[model samples]
Target: MKVLYLGDLVGRSGREAAIKRLPELRERLKADFVVVNGENAAGGFGITPAICDDLFAAGTDVIVTGNHVWDNRDILPHFQRENRLLRPANFPEGAPGRGIGVYDVPGGRRIAVAQVMGRIFMDAMDCPFRAVDKALAAYPLGRTVQFTLVDVHAEATSEKMAMGHHLDGRATMVVGTHTHAPTADHQIFSGGTAYMSDIGMCGDYDSVIGMQKAEPIRRFIHKTPGARFAPADGEATVCGVFVESDDKTGLATRIDPVRVGPRLAETMPEVV
Candidate 1:
C-alpha cells in the first residue's frame, strides 16, 4: 500500500496547488491513497464543503483538519454527511465530525486514517495519547485494516516525536501537521512506522507561513492588531510525505519528503 499525506493547506494558493498538481503528484508518487489536511484552506482559517469537493475530485481520498476545523460554522452541518472529512479525534464527544475513517483500497484491503490534536501548545483537548491508543486498538493493522496512519496536529515537536515513538509498531505512519514548516526528519522506525515531525504547508512560501506577509509583520512590530489575515496568493509549493508499505504486512518500508513549486526545490520518493 502507498499513502501520500499532505500537510496543512494554507488558502487559495495552497488549494490551487493541490487542485492543479495533485493528479500529477499521484501519478509521479504512484500513490494508492491520498490524505490532505484542509484546516487552513478557507482563507487560512476554515475549510468549506466546496473546497473539499474540489480536493476529492482531484483524487484526494480523505481530508484531515486541525485546531481551526470549526472556524467556519457552515462545516458543522456538512460533517454529519461527509465521511471523507475528518476533525481531530481528541475533540470532545458529540463534536460535529468524526476523526476515524476507513476506506476500501483494492483486493479487499482497507486503509484507515485518523487525526488527533496535541495540547502542549495548541488548544486543549482530550488526551491525544489515550485517544490514539483507543483508535489503534479498535483497528489492528494487517488484520483489522491493511494499513493505517494517524496525523498528530500540534505545535510542539517533542509531543509529536513522543507520539511517533508511542505508536511506533502500531501504525503505518505518524505524521505531524500545524507547524507549516516541514521538518527534516523522515525515517521508518524500527517498528515499521514511518515518521515525520511535520509535512509542511502547501502554499506560497514567500509569506509568513501561508498568510500574507505584511499583516503578521506589522502586528509583531507594533504589538497591535492589523488587517485581518489572508492567504498568500503567490505561487505555491505542494508539500507532503510519501510512504510505501509492505504488501503483506502493511508496514512502511520506505519514506520520503515531497515538495514541488517555485519556492522550494522539488522532491519525490521512489515508492509503492
Candidate 2:
C-alpha cells in the first residue's frame, strides 16, 4: 500500500497550498491513502469543520490533530460526528472524538489511523504508550488488518522516538507531528516501521513555524504578547513523509520525505 502522510497544515496559505497541490501530488505519487495533520489548518491553531471538509474535498482521507485540536470551539461538535477527524486519544475520558479510526482505502483495503499526544512538554494527558498499545491491541496487524498509521503528536523528539520504537513492527508507519519543523531522520526501522521525528508544518518556510515571525520574536526578545497570532503571508510549502508498505504484513518497505512548493527544495525518493 502506498500512503502519503503530510505534516500539519497551518493557516490560510498552508491550506490553500495543500488544496492546490494535493491533487497533482496524489496523481504523481499514486498514493492510495492520504493522511494530513489538520491541527493547525485553521489560521494556525485548531481546525474547523469547513477546513476539514475542504481538506476532504482536496483528497485527504484521514485528518489527525494534537493540542490545538480544540482551539476553534466550533469544531467540538464536528469532532463528535466526524469519523475521519481524530483528536489525541489520550486526551481524557469523554473527550469529543476518538483517537483511532478504521477506514477504507482505494483498493478496498482497511487502514487504521491512531493519534496519541505525548505528555512531555505538552498538556497533561493519559499515557501515550498505554493509549497506543490499547488502540493497536484492538487491531493487530497481519491477522485482521493490513495497514496502520500512528500520528504521534508531540513536542519532545525523544518521546516521539520512543513511541516509534515502542510501536516498531506493529504499525506500517509511525510519524511525528507538532513542533512545526520537519526533521531529516526519515528511515525504515529494522522492525519494518517507517518513522520520522516530525513531518513539519505545511506552511510558509519564511515564518516562525507557520506563524508570522514578528510575534514569536517579540515574545522571545521582549517576553510579552503585543498582538494576536497570524499565519505568515509568504510562499507556502507542503512537507511530510511518504511510505510504501507490504500488503501482507503491512510493514513499511520504503520511506521518504516530501517537500514541495516555494522556499523548500523539492525531492523524491530514489528507491534502492
Candidate 3:
C-alpha cells in the first residue's frame, strides 16, 4: 500500500495549494490513501465545514487536526457528521469528533488513520500513547488492515519521535505535524515503519511558520501584543511524505519527501 500524508495547512494559500495539487499528486505518486492535516486551514486558526468539503472534493481521504481543531466554533457540530475529519484521539471523552477512522480502499484493502496530540508545551490532554494503543488494538496491521497511519500533531520533536517508536512495526507509517517546518529525518525504522519528525506545512515558507512575518516580528521585538497573526499569502510550498509499504506485512518499504512550489527546493519522488 502507498500512502501520502501532508502536514498542517496554514490558511488560504496552504489549502488552495493543496486543492490545486492533490489530484496530480495522487496520480503521480500512485497513493492508495491520502491524509492531510487541516488544523490551520481556516484563517490560520481552525478549520470549518466548507474548507473540509473543499479538501475532500480535492481528493483528501481523511483530514486530521491538532490543538486548533476547536478554534472554530462552527466545526463543533460538523465533527459528528463527518467521521473523515478527526481531532486528536487523546482528547477527553465526550469530545465532538472521534480520533480515529477506518476506511476501505479500492482494491478491497483497508486503511486506518489515527491522530494524537502531544502534551509537551501544548494543552493538557489524555495520554497520547495509551490513546493510540487503544485505537490500534482493534485494527491489527497486516491482518485486519492493509495499512495504518498515525499523525502525531505535536510541538516537540521528541514527543513525536517517541510516538513513532512506540508504534513501530505495528503501523505502516508514523509521521508528525504542527511544527510547520519539514525535518530531514525521513527514514524507515528497523521494524519497517516509516517515520518523519515533521512533514512541514503546505503554506508559504517566507514568513514565520506560515504566518505574516511583520506581526510576529513585532511581538518578538516589542514584547507586546500587536496585530493578529495572519497567514502569508505568497505562493505556498506543498509539503508531505510519501510511503510505500509491503502488502503482506503492512510495513514501509520506501519513504520519500514531497515538496513542491516556490520558496523551497522542489523534490518529488520518481513515479516509476
Cα lDDT, all candidates:
0.91, 0.89, 0.94
* Model 1 Cα lDDT, one tens digit per residue, 1-272: 88898889999999998889999989988888999999999999999999999999999999999999999999999899999999999999899889899999977889999999999967779999999888778789888898999999999999999999999888999999998999999999999999999999999999999988899999999999778998899999999999888767878988899998998888877643
Task: Pick out the ten consecutive residues of candidate 2 with the lowest summed lDDT.
Answer: 263-272
Candidate 2 lDDT by residue in tens digits, 1-272:
88898899989988899889899888778888899999888888899999999999999999998999988999999987899999988988998989999987766678999999999988899999999999889788876678999999988999999999999999999989998898989999989999999988899999988899888899999987689889996889989888998888999998889999878788765543
Is candidate 1 or 2 superior in TM-score? 1
TM-score of each: 0.98, 0.97, 0.99
Give the lDDT of residue 175 in candidate 2: 88
Model 1 — TM-score against the truth?
A: 0.98
Better of 2 and 3 by TM-score: 3
* Candidate 3 lDDT tens digits, 21-105: 9999999999888999999999999999999999999999999999999999999999999989999999999999899999999
Error of 1 at 170 (Å): 0.2
Best by TM-score: 3
